[model samples]
Target chain A: MKEIMAIVRMKKTGATKKALVATGVAGFTAVKVIGRGKLVTDTDELEKCREKLLALGLDEVSDAGDTETLVTSFLDGSRFFPRRLFTILAHDEDVPRIIEAITTANRTDYGIGDGTIFVLPVADAVRVRTGEAGEAAIW
Target chain B: MLLIRAIVRPEKKDEVLAGLSEAGFNAATMVDVVGRGKQKGIKIGGMVYDEIPKILILVVIPDGEKEKVVKVILSTARSRNEGAFGDGKIFVSPVEEAYTISKNALGL
Candidate 1:
């Protein structure tokens, strides 16, 4: 069995979760992160991004100010790009297809509009609530 | 099932997401990533670029979804005006089996 993880970018927040669920992914975990990409070119683009984020109340500079409200709630931040981790347990043969799906979901020719895919061997997995074990049995 | 992984140009993330969403596959995960490919990150003068921000997108999909997903990704990543360079690559592998421990949902 295997486990797959992806770092995807969505136009808006929550798209990743929705897309993954639609693909019939059994279960996955997501984590919020911060990253910078090559997309930001000049002051115009940066200003536009900052303005858009501020209007959405996603821009946070102060510790307990406008952004603290969404730190955990909305996964919102002023980061160039929000980093999120998606992980799933699967069988070995399913790796390639999963990577393809993610690539399709995040590709761009211009700046940093792309996604990366990663896979790892699953030693063991268990559903804490149900006590399920093994890669196949506990995805 | 096959696991398809891609490290793409960061700007095209939305296109990738939309492509997957339109293809009836919407669920996925993302993480802030830093790495370089082919160009070995980026080049300037004689110095090597150390840190480049990228995203790692991963998915576990049925075999049938691989081709379609790849096509979508390649198309989305390719620039209409220009092409090649930082379009990135996609990696594929197999999944032995799948199941949800709590519900015992197997190989869906």
Candidate 2:
């Protein structure tokens, strides 16, 4: 067995769920999370801030000591964005289909925060009510 | 690399994270979950509360850091001096690879 984890944008969760179900995933776990990737700045906000500084007659805002602090503060608030994380357990052969379903559902024009998927090995599984173990428990 | 999934008491989540951070294993992902262990949940008066709240902390570390990381979680996630039932469980699993979504890099 393998555990497939996908971190996706909050808005795309509903579509992702439908796609996974269509691919024959019986069960999965999802939770709300806040995370970020390598890119930290919010360029749109930075542009607005820059325009404001320029209107105030500070053309050299990039070299201004205080404006540097202003830019950093504006970027800090956007460092982490809301996301949804889904965890699914599946047979080895089913991994590819599941990944394809998720990716197709989540891909958007704005690429950076689309999300990520990871697969990890699962040594064992157990069903509490039936006391069943291994693959039997998962299926 | 190996990923350690530790399902611990909600109250002990912070302590565990702190312990790991102090030990230099700083990055971890946490989720709020509800589960029941071998004790089969708890009963209070007329109610049988089967879904107990838990915090699942996931940390991916190099193969060599497994012992140290697990040790930190064990000590800090324990409820009392001697430990007790429902202290939670930890599972370690192999990780094939890691990637940075923004950079599209191959590995962490």
Candidate 3:
């Protein structure tokens, strides 16, 4: 079995769920979590971003007056956004389809922070009630 | 340490907990979950139930004690003799790393 985890934006969760269900992925668990990544809003980090941008030879930041506004606008994106982690345990063959559905539902024009998907192997599964083990335990 | 994920009948949570604690395997996380087993849910009279409530218990324990831990859960969580549908499932997997957040300690 394969455990598929999709970390996605809160706004896209509904659509993603619909897509997964449509693809016949039987069940999933969603947990709310906070994550930090490349996006930054702190002053020092903003300054560093400006330095990197300048080093790229943008040349437009020669005037001190324009740099402040430029920096603010550059870092105006979200610092931290609520994310939902969707975990699904499925048959190995279904992993690719499930990942595709999540990506298609959550895709956005802005490339960064769209979210991520991970697939891991499950050694075995046993049904608690019937004592069924292995493939028979999961639906 | 290996990660053990057990999905069991919600009503069996207490027994499972008791078993784990008695066996000196107390660290676990529990969550309410809904799923359908190989039976694809049950049809009671005229009603067709698609999703059933289950409890998911996650525990990370030392590798050597895997069989013992599994036995504790299996005995405590099983629903009936010879087993019945919707009993839930237990999944075993390896853990690459584990950390204690407050102390910044690694492993168990």
The fnat scores of all predictions, in order, read 0.04, 0.28, 0.00
TM-score (chain B only), all candidates: 0.84, 0.94, 0.94
Q: In candidate 1, what are the lDDT values of residues A1-139, reduced to their tens digit?
A: 7677555554522666665666667878777754332223366644554455457644444554756454433322223456665777766666666655555455543323344455557677777888878764745
TM-score of each: 0.46, 0.61, 0.47
Q: lDDT for each of the candidates?
A: 0.60, 0.78, 0.71
Tens digit of per-residue lDDT, candidate 3, span B1-108: 677889999899889877887787755555667888888789999998988998877677777999999999999898886777777889988754343322223444
lDDT of 2 by residue, A1-139 (tens): 8898888888999999999999999799998975544333577845765566455654364657766666555444333467898999988889878877887888775555677777888888998999999888877
Q: Can you give the lDDT of residue A126 in candidate 2?
A: 92
Per-residue lDDT tens digits of candidate 2, residues B14-101?
7987788778765566678899999889988988888999988777787898899989999999988899999999999888755444
- Residue pairs whose backbone atoms clash in candidate 2: none
Clashing pairs in 3: A129-B87, A130-B83, A130-B84
Candidate 3 chain B lowest-lDDT run of ten: B97-106
Comparing 1 with 2 on TM-score, the higher-scoring candidate is: 2
DockQ of each: 0.04, 0.23, 0.03
Chain A accuracy as TM-score for every candidate: 0.57, 0.73, 0.69
Clashes of each: 63, 0, 3
Please report the candidate that would top TM-score against the real structure: 2
Candidate 1, after superposition: displacement of residue A72 in Å?
18
